[model samples]
Target: MTSQKLSIINISYKNDESVRVLTAVLSKWFSNPKTLHFTSPNLKYPFNINHWISTFYNEDNIETYILKDENWIIGHISVKIDENKNLAHLFHLFIDNENRQKGYAKKLIRYVEKHIIAGKDNIKAINLNCVKKNIPAITLYQSIGFQILKEKKWLKMIKYIDKK
Candidate 1:
């Protein structure tokens, strides 16, 4: 990644062909056993399209963003804000096979923090969960200021942000 700006778009508001394409690609990516084990999203590998579609559009507080390297789709991530709890939960962060190790993951995460979730009302901490065995992901998260919050069944991490 360079100093060049990356392109990101919110795709959670639609239920169209584009979303259909998104679901297919997401399914293919998750279908890989390694990817499935690392990310550990709620949906099963090769998830039902209708269910994923409904989950995507009907979630009121969550917004999913697609990160692009110019015209190519590099990755996608979602953020869910809990107003009453003053926190935001990050999930479903992934980079495509060819885009890994290029600093795009950090770029995507920071873009969401600064552009999407930071100014939201009273959102004090951003949190996420990942498998302990996923060392690369864990290291990346730690490098970007996410500290381990727990080490139980699933590794949980958090970073507190200043709105001011």
Candidate 2:
């Protein structure tokens, strides 16, 4: 069987309509209490859309992206860069429940690593925190050269981006 290729669409927070679409997708994903807590530990239960908007869309340093396979939204991921620290933090990575295990997550990560961080001289490393129990996400991060940092509660993975 042949597989379909997914495209990463960059979302601009300045566009209210686009932000609404992104928020809707996030709201749907965060609707599940377990997913809400797992993806966003600081957020309360019930998945407030306004809160989600304020948290993600209002951030100037964060850039959001969505992975789509022609017809469906496969997943979403965001990168937040700290200019002072020269660090890029990966956040809110979630693959649709129906699209899990299809390698979309890996593709999304690679896209960010290559297009987003590779050429940026100021970006020293990329970091993300994966819940210890989330074995699949941990494995994916490790496979993509993210080393486990010394953290107990949540596994902190760091991948140094070499500038060319």
Candidate of highest TM-score: 2
Q: lDDT for every model? A: 0.81, 0.83
Clashing pairs in 2: none
lDDT of 2 by residue, 1-110 (tens): 12576679998767888777867777788888989877877789998867876876677888878898775676989998887999999988999888889888998889
For candidate 2, what is the lDDT?
0.83
What TM-score should be assigned to candidate 2? 0.89
- Among all windows of 10 consecutive residues in model 1, the one with the lowest summed lDDT is 40-49
Q: List the residue pairs that clash in candidate 1.
A: none
Cα deviation of 131 in candidate 1 (Å)? 1.0
Misplaced by over 4 Å in model 2 are 1-5
Q: Which RMSD values do the candidates have, in order? A: 2.6, 2.1
The Cα RMSD of model 2 versus the native structure comes to: 2.1
Q: How accurate is candidate 1 locally (lDDT)?
A: 0.81
Off by over 4 Å in 1: 1-5, 53-57
